[model samples]
Target: MSSLQDIPVHVAAEWGNALPVLHEIRHALERLAETGEARVIDLNAMPFGPGDEDRLLGLLGQGEIEARLDALGVTQIRETAVPGVWLVDHRNADGERLVLHVEIAEVPAILRTQAEDLRDAVAALDARLATGASPFPHRPDN
Candidate 1:
């Protein structure tokens, strides 16, 4: 049998950035667990070697929840296989990426309704009820 030193492992000339990203995620997760503080990492701001991003994403894998929002542009939010980890993509109308964020939280902030919107919704609901319109958009399936 050949000596262990004879093994051929192809190493890249430059270090892979994927592990660093994972490290960041791991630390952020720890902070979140300890302090309930969420962290967001901007992937665009990081330097990525060839295949680094793909490797990182592959490692993250996919989870159950996905959300798509379209306003001025499109925003895609997906949960990673790791609980409390999320991937968020903000894209322009032209399908260009504006920001790519890895968010560590129970749920990504983008999914939460803002206080201003919630207050407005309260007023809107009262007005609709005052107008005697059916409050329920769809009747119960009784």
Candidate 2:
């Protein structure tokens, strides 16, 4: 098995809304969990930006992200920051890690029906960005 140093930064996203894009984040974590051993650092929930830190704690408790990760058996670490990005580290059976970086925003009703598709769409965006390709506007394939 590879040590933590073997972990590769395969996925990452900037700060954004914890609720609007959380489903995609869960899907990413699910993909990582499927590999059996993976860790995700959720920086979106962290306090950041002007007046965003104004709240000591709002109605959106921290439980949402943590609970989802626990259900997936994926390790999750949280930090404070802007509200739109999420970073994930994925692992393979060989114990090699690949990072999955994501930029999550509100998914339109057209694409929000299924959970897996949302994940795939976001992952696709990450792939495009990594390859230095421009993202064509997402049209609902459904």
Per-candidate TM vs. native? 0.81, 0.22
Measured with C-alpha atoms, the lDDT of residue 45 in candidate 2 is 52
Give the lDDT of residue 8 in candidate 1: 77
Per-residue lDDT of 108 in model 2:
17
**Candidate 2 lDDT, tens digit per residue, 1-142?**
4687598745354334444345545564565556633334334455444333223224223422221132223423222242323333334444353333242322212223468877798888777677754445763333
Best by TM-score: 1
Per-residue lDDT tens digits for candidate 1, residues 1-142, read 3786598756566457899899999999999999999999999998987678878999999999999989669999999999989999999999899999999999899899988899899898687677755758875333
Which ten contiguous residues of candidate 2 have the minimum total lDDT? 63-72
Given candidate 2, what's the lDDT at residue 105? 29
